[model samples]
Structure formats: structure tokens, C-alpha cells
Target: MVSAPLPASALPQDSKDRLRLWIRLLRASRTIEAELRERLKQQFDTTLPRFDVLAALYRSPEGMLMSDLSRYLLVSNGNVTGIIDRLVSEGLVLRARRNGDRRTSIVRLTRAGSEQFRAMAAAHEGWIDELLGGVSGNDTQRLTAMLKSFRSNWEGRE
Candidate 1:
């Protein structure tokens, strides 16, 4: 497949705006995620996906099913299953066949898992603080509000 080079002036205005927004988002996300992962490894010997799963489980009032975890993490069922397998093997998570539902399993964070998650959550917040400390508090608030507004508008679309 052959693609023609796009001159900046020739590109649609909306296309250029979308491209710039995506590029900024991707770069910022990557840098922040990379730093978070590095700190997680150094401090907790965990990865972002594992932390994400545990964080989701931490938020569930009655725990979460494997399918629910997959959806919450925006990952494939196979991926969630593999993550569950490892966490269960490490005794950080418990998987039980739901009452009256042998085919469905609900997973919960164990006491140890909760403690680990709390520590990780603290460290994660510290990392975020480190990243944004240079920015003024008011600016941070405005930026967060703007992002929320943008997200609301974006979700309202389509």
C-alpha cells in the first residue's frame, strides 16, 4: 500500500487537531506509565496491569467476577484469567465458586492483597505528586476540570 505524504496546510483542520491531541496524550501517558512501572517494580515487584487488577478488586464492594475484572481492566478474558492464576498462586487473591453458581467464580483480594494495595496506592500517589509538583495547585485544579469537561463532552458524542 502506498500512502501520500500530507502537507500540514493540506490536512483537514479537525484531523490536525485530533492528531496533535492524540500525540500529546500518548506521550504523556507513556512517560507517566513508564515512571509508575519503574517505581512499582523497585518498590513492590509488581507491574501496572497487576496493580490495575488489584485496584479494581479493591474497589468492588463484594469482590468481582473474572469477567467483570476483564471488563474493568479493559483486557481480554484470557489475560484476566492469567493474571488471576498468578495472583491466586501468590496467595494475594482468592477465587471462589459463587454460591449456587458453580460455573461462575468471584475473586477477592486477600488481607495481604489489601495491605499490598494500600502501600502501592500510596506510592502511586507519591509518584503522581512528583510528576505534577512543579505545576501550581490552581493550575492543576483547572486542568483537571478542563479534562473532565472534555471527557464529558467526548463521551456525550455518538
Candidate 2:
């Protein structure tokens, strides 16, 4: 993996650009995630994974199963259990075993949790805006479009 960091022009005709893009994406994600975590921690005493679960639940149409939350949060069931336990203890989330399905538990953001998520989301939006605000609307749109295209292409899905 320590091959020469070949110049763009020096890269193989086919794979160079994509490799460069992947490198940039990984670096950018790490930087942004670190920054967001710091900001969220300072403002809300929340970790990124916690925020992610809340955000996912906040968007669920009618709450969500623990399994779904784990998948959406990209975490393991045990990890989700830890998070859910903490959230429940904080009165930020409530879990109920699905009717006729004792093995399946549904999790929902409590009133307090929903309010907290809203507040955090507002601040988060502002932070993101502050971080990317320098870019013009046109550029932002173009970037989104490009990213969407890249994702679709990479995933081989519509």
C-alpha cells in the first residue's frame, strides 16, 4: 500500500483518478467526522454513534427495530445494546417488545430525546453550514450531484 504516490498524469489511464478520489474521500470523511465529534461533544455531550442512532430514529416513520437501528447506525447488535441502554437510562429512548414478537424490540426517541435531537440537529446544521458555507450554492449543488453520481456508479444501483 506504500507504493509511490504517483502524480495524476503518471497514473494508469483507467484506475488513477478513481484511486485518488477514494483516497480523498477517506481523508475527508475522517477529518469531517473528527471535527463533528468534537463539536457535538462540546455542545451536546454526545458521541457520533449516539448522534447517529438518534438521528436515525428521529427519521423513522414509526420508530424502528433494534436490528434496523444497528444496521442503520453501522454498528453491531451489542454496540447498539450499549447505546440503547445508555439512551434508555438517560430517558432519551424507550424500547418496547413488538406485539406477538417478544424477541423483537422497537426503539423510539422519547419526547426528551426528540427535543434533544432537534436541538442538536439545528446546531449541527449550523456547524455544517459554517464548515461548508464558503462554497457557493451552485458549487454545493454541483458537488452534491457529482457525489450522488459517483455513489450510484460505484454501487451499480440506480
Per-residue CA lDDT of candidate 2, range 31-89, in tens?
88899999999989899989999999999948999998898777899999999999999
CA shift at 80, candidate 1, in angstroms?
0.9
lDDT of 2 at 44: 90
The ten-residue window of minimal lDDT in model 2 covers: 149-158
lDDT against the true structure, each candidate: 0.91, 0.90
**Which residue ranges in model 2 land beyond 4 Å of their true spot?**
1-10, 156-158
lDDT of 1 by residue, 1-158 (tens): 99988999999999999899989989998998999999999999999999999999999848998888898787999998898899999998999998969888899999999999999999899899999789899998998998999898888466
Screening candidate 2 with a backbone cut-off below 3 angstroms (N, C-alpha, C), the clashing residue pairs are none
RMSD of 2: 3.6
Off by over 4 Å in 1: 1-6, 12-18, 156-158
Task: Itemize residue pairs with steric clashes in candidate 1.
Answer: none
TM-scores, one per candidate = 0.86, 0.86
- How many Å off is the CA of 84 in candidate 1? 1.0
